[model samples]
Target chain A: MISSSRFLPRVSGLALFLFLVVPAPSLVPARAADPAEIRIGYLHLAESKQQPISLLDEPTDDDGIAGARMAVEDNNGTGRFTNQHFSIEDMRLKPSDDAAAAAKSLIDKGILLIVVDLPPGMVLTAADAGRASGATLFDAGSSDDSLREEDCRANVIHTAPTRSMLADALAQYLAWKRWQRWLLVTGSHPQDALYADALKRAAKRFGSTIVEERIFKDTGGARRTDTGIVQTQRQMPVFTQNAPAYDVLVAADESNVFAGYLPYRTWDARPVAGSAGLVPTSWDPAHDSWGAVQMQNRFIKLAHRRMKAIDMQAWTAVRMIGEGATRTQSADPAKIVAYIKSPSFEIAAFKGQKLTLRDWNLQLRQPILLSDGRTVVSVSPQEGYLHQTSELDTLGYDRPETKCKLN
Target chain B: MQAQLIRRGRIRRWPPLWLSLALTVGATSSAFAYTAYVTNERDNTVSVVDLDKMQTVKTIQVGQRPRGIVISPDGKFLYICAGDDDIVQIVDTKSQQVVGDLPSGPDPELLALNKTGDLLYLSNENDALVTIIDVKERKALAQIPVGVEPEGMGVSPDGKIVVNTSETTNMAHFIDTDKRDVVANVLVDARPRYAEWKSDGSEVWVSAEVGGTVSVIDPVKHVVTKKITFSVPGLRSEAIQPVGIRFTKDGKLAFVALGPANRVAVVNAQTHEVEKYLLVGQRVWQLAFTPDQKYLISTNGVSNDISVIDVADLKVIKSIQVGSFPWGVAISPE
Candidate 1:
C-alpha cells in the first residue's frame, strides 16, 4: 500500500499532472483512495536568552517541538489502521518576526490546526490572524489567567495550565497538610506580581491565611556571579529575618530572581513552596506511575532528554488533534473541532485519567503534579476539596467563577 | 470442569456455577481452597494468596514489571506477562517455581488463553501488535498488528474470535483466530484497558479507564449495543475510571474495577446497569474469581492490597496486603 503511493511521485510531470487533474474519485474504488493528509502547524517564538539557575536546568534546542514531532509519529502509528496520515510544519519566529504573518502563511498552506508556543500577546495575535480562516489554535505556551478568563477566544484552546491553577494546586496541598499560615514573598518583576496575585487568590479560596507579605527587589547585577552561593548564603537569611510566624514560605518568583535560593536559606526554617520547592506543574520527569513510564521511555528515546512541562503541553496539544482526527475519521477540520468541543470528547495522555476541555473557556482540565525536583510529592485538588462536576474543576476557575464569554 | 459434570448427566447445563457450588458443598466437609497469583508491577514479584486462608502464602521473585497473568486449563501452570522482560514466564502451580518461558513480543501487558490452553494471545503494548503463541512449542505463531498501545485481550467463548482493545486508538479490533486478521473494528470510548465476554457469547464488555465507561459491544454486528456508567456520591466522574472487568459464569453479575475511585462497581450483566459500588483499596486495577465462585478478589494498585468480596452476599469480606503496586490477578482451578 505504501509502495503504490511512493511510486506516484516518481512519475513524469505530465503523467502526475494528468493523474492529479483526472478527477479519479469517480473511477477508483473508495478504499483505494490515498490516505487523507492532515497537516498541522507548530508556531513557536525563539527562546529567550535568560540563563537557568542551575546548568543542569538548561533546555534542549527542540524542547517543545520535539514532543510535537513524537506525537506525529504516534499519530501515524494509529493512522495506519484508519487510512490517514499526519505531518507537522514547524516555524520558529525571531524577535522581530510578525507572528500574525507567520500564522497567515500557515493558513495559506491549508493547515487548519496550529499549535502555538508564544507569549500571551503573540498568542492573541496569531489567534486573531487565524480566526477569519476558520483555523483552530492550540495555546501550548502562555499560562496567563487572562487568556482563559476575560480574553478567552472561541477559536483557541489552551493546553497550558493557568497560574491560578498552579497556585490553587499548591495551596490545596498545603491546606491538606495543615499549613494554613503562609509568609508570601514576591519578586519585583511584573510576572512575579501576577503570580503573587494568583497565590493570594488561592489562599483566600482555600482558607489559608497569608500572615505577611514581602518584596524582594531585583537589583541591577549579573544573575550568575563568580561568588554565587557564598554571597547568597549570607544575603538570603538576613533578607528573610523577622517575618511573622508561618507554616510555610510561599515564593512567587516567576522572574527567576530568588526562589531557588530560598529553600535552605529561610530564617524561620519553613519549607518553601511556589516556584522552587514542591513546585506545581503539568508534567515532571519524576512522574512514573499510571503508565507514564511508557511515555517517558518513548520521549527519552526521541529527544534524548527528560520531558519537561512545555514538552508535555505541546505533546498533549498535538495528541488532542490526532485524537480528534481519529474520532471523526475525516480530515475535515470543522468536524474535528466540533467533535473536540462536544461533551463526549476526552483524550488520555498518561495522566492516570482522561483530560477534557472546559466548554465555557476552552481550557484543558487536568491534575497538577507537585514536585520537589526529584520525585512527585503529590498531585493536587487534595482529598476533601470537591466539585459538583469534576474534581479537576476544583483546581481552577469553576464555571460560576469564569468571566469568559466566548465569541 | 463443569462440562464434564454435564456430560455425565449429573447436573443441568444452565446455572452451572451454582450447581457446581452446591456439589462442592455436598462433596467436601471443609471449604475448598483455591490459590490466587497476583503480579505486583512495582516490586516485580508474584504474591500467592490462598483463598481459604485469606492471606498471602508466599511471595515469589519474577521477571521485571509483571502485570498480566493467567492459569492453565488443568490448573498446573501459570503464565505471567513479564512486560519489561518482554517474555511470558511459565511457573508450575504446585512447585511454585519458574518452569519455562514463552516467546512473547515486546512489552506484553496483557494475555488471554484459549479453552484448550494451547494457544496464547499477548497484547504487546509498545509494539502495537497482538502476538499469538503456541504454548507447548513455546514459539510465536504470528505477530498481527492491531492498533496503537494494545492493552486488553479477550478470546471469544467458542475460541473462534479474539478481541484486543487499543488504548490510544480507542477502538476494539476483533481478530479471527484462524486467519489471525482483524475482521472488524468497533470504536469505543477513550483508553480502553480490559475486555470481557459473556459466557453465552451474546455481548462483549470493554472497560475504558479514561472515558469512565464500559461499552457493551455486540460481537456479531460489531457495534456498541449499550454503555455502563458508574457514579459514586461526592466523587468526580473522572475519578471513576473503569479498568478490569469480570462477569459471573452464569452471566447475571459483573464486577468492574474502578481505578482511583477506590471502589468496585457491581453491574447487572443482563440490564447493563450499575447495581452497587463497593468501596475497596485505592487504585484498583484487576479482578478475579475463585474456581468455586465463592469469592471475588481485586488487586488494588495504590494501597498495595487485595480486597476479597463474597460473591453471594456482595460484601467485602477481607483485605489482604500484598506486594507494592499489585496490578493483575489469576486464580487456579481446584
Candidate 2:
C-alpha cells in the first residue's frame, strides 16, 4: 500500500502522457489545460582513478546523478498538484569527450536546464556552447575561485563553494577558537597552490598570521601500500619538525596527497584543519540537525549510501530549477532563468535558512559546514562576524571585489 | 473506567460552593493561573509547570520523541504525539499518568482536535497521510492521503474542515471532515510547518519555516489572500523563520514564534502588520496560552527552557528551565 501510493502520481502522469500522445481528438485537452513539462540535463565527467586517501570516502558510481534524480523526484511530488511534471536526462562524458558537444546535444533535445559536474575549463566550454541556445548551466563540482571571478561565465550558476569560501569558513572557526597562528603546509600540485593562496587570503582577512610555510611534494608514489601506515607515521613528524611556533597546522592538499596523514602524525601537539582534519564542506553525512535528518534519510534511501558534498551541490542546483519552475508556473526556459536570477528566488536545502543567489556573481550564498570526517564540528559564517548585507557574503568575495561582469 | 471519567469530568466542571466562594473572595485576579504541560522531545518526558508558581512542579515520562501535544476540552486528558513510537499516548491529567495510546500512523509530528474534542487528526510525516482517529474509541477512522512530509494539522473553529501543511510539497491541504478527503490544496511558501485558523473561521494562516513568511488563506475561496513577512533590524531575513502562531481571545493580536531568531513577533491581526518583537530563549519552537489569557509561554528547544510573556504588556517576564529540547506545550483550562 505504501509503495502503491508513492507511485500513483507517476502512474497517472504516464497515463496522461499516453493519452496526449494518441491521435484521438476526444482524448486531447486544450493547449491551456495541458500540464507544463520541465526537463533538466545532468552532465558529469566519468569516474576517475583519483580517489580520496580514505577507503571510506570513495565516490559511488551514481554520486552526482543520484542527487539530481532525488531532486527530480521531489519536484514531481510538488508538481502533481500544480499540473506540472519534471524529468531529467543524464549524460556521462569520458575524459577525452568534448563537454560542449555533450551539452549542445542535451540542449537540442529541449532540456535547457543543465547541471555540470566537471573541471573548471570544461564547465566554461559547456556554458559557452549552451549560451546560443539560451540554456542555463549549474556548476556543481569545481571549487576553483577563478570560475567565479576572472574566468566566470554569464550563463553559469555556481552551487559549489569557491576555495575562498571554504578557506574563510575554516579561518573564521579558527579565529573564534583564538588559534591566531597557522603553520601552512602546501602540496606541490597547481590546484593545491590555488587553495594555499585562498588560505593566505583568508588568514589576512580574518586577522590571523601564518607563522611559517612548508611544502609537501607528491613525488609520485602509491597512495595505499602495505607499508603506508608505518612510513607516514615516521615520515610526517620529521617532515613537519621544527616549524615556527604556531597554534594550528593548516594543509592545502586538494589533490588528496598528505593532509589526511597530518592529524596525529604532526611533530608538534597542534590541531590540523583545512583540506583534511576539520575540513569545510557544503554537506556532510553526520549532519542531522535543522530538519536535515529527513533529507539525509531520503537521500540514503534513494542512493543506498550516505550523501556527499558533490551530491548536495548537484541536488541544490536541480532544486533551484524546480523552485524557479514552481514559483513562476512556467516551463519556458527564459522565464525560469529570469525568475531564478531575480532577488525573490530563495531555496531551502535544509541549511537552517533559505539560500539565495548572489546577483552579481550568480554564486549560491550558503553557510559552510566544518566537519571532522565523523561529525560536524560547526557551521561557518559564525556569530559576531557580520556583513552589511548578508553574513554569507562575508565568506566569499563581496560585490565590491568582484572581477565578474556579466554581459 | 467510563463512570470514573464522567465523575471526574463533572467535578472539574463545577467547583464546590465553599471553595468557589473562597476563591472569588480572596485574590480573585492574582490566583487565576493554570498548569502548563510541556513535551520534551530529547528527554522523552513532559514537565508540568505551575503558572502561579512560575516553575516546573513535576515531570511525567512518556514514549520516545514526544513532539505535538494537545489537551482535551474538559481538561481531563492530554494527547502526546510520540513520533518514534508511532502512537499518541493519552495522559490522565488528574493522575498525570499514561492511561492509553491511540493508533496514530507513522511518524506523527503535529496534531489537531475537533471542537467537541472527540475526533483527533494528526499528520503522519513519513507516510504523507492525515490519520483521523476516534479519540474515545482509540482507533483510526480514516487515513487521508496528502502531500509529502505533512507536519502541521489545523482544524476550523466550526469543526467542518481540517488543514494539513506539507513541508516539501509547500501546500496547505484542506480536508473535509465529513467526507474525510482533500477538498482543496492551496500553494503556500516553501516548507510550510504550521497551520492556524482564525477564531471567526474567515482565514487560515500557514507558517513557512523556509520561505520565511506566513500565508493567510481565505478558507471559503481556498486562496492565499496575504503573505506576511517578518523583518528584524539586526537579523538576516533567512533566520526569521515563523513557526507556531497563536491569536488572542479578542482576535486583535497574534504571536508568532520565530525559530532560531530567539524572539516572538507580535502582529496586529486586523492590519496584518507586525507591532513588536519580544526576545525570548534560544530556538523557540512552540507556544501556549494560560487559561485566563494573562500570560503566554514559549518553548525554547535549544535553551531547554520556557519563556513566559505578559500578553497585555507585551513583555517577556520570566524564563523557567525545563527538560532538554522542550518542543510542544499545552495548558489546562483551570
Chain A: TM-score in each model:
0.91, 0.92
Ten contiguous residues with the weakest lDDT in model 2 chain B: B1-10
Per-residue alpha-carbon lDDT of model 2 for B14-98, expressed as tens digits? 2345633654564346556588999999999999998766789999999999999999999999999998887899999999999
* Every candidate's lDDT: 0.87, 0.87
How does candidate 1 score on lDDT? Answer: 0.87
Residues B1-334, candidate 1, lDDT per residue (tens digit)? 3342231233222225675466457445444668889999989999999766668999988899999999999999999999888778999988999988887767789999999999999997766778788888776665667777888999999999999999877889888888777877888898899999999999999999999999999999999999888889878787889999999999999999999998999999998888999878889989999887888999999889998887887877567889999999999887
Which candidate gets the maximum TM-score versus the true structure?
A: 2
Candidate 2: where is the Cα deviation over 4 Å? A1-34, B1-33
TM-score, predicted candidate 1 vs. hidden true structure: 0.89
The 10-residue segment of model 1 chain B with minimum total lDDT is B5-14
Query: Candidate 2 on A162-264: residue-level lDDT in tens?
Result: 9999999999999999998999999999999999999999999999999998999999877788878988999999999999989999999999989998999
Backbone clash count for every predicted candidate, in the order shown: 0, 0
Write down the C-alpha DockQ for each prediction.
0.26, 0.26
- DockQ-based class of model 1: acceptable
Angstrom error at residue B204, model 2: 0.6
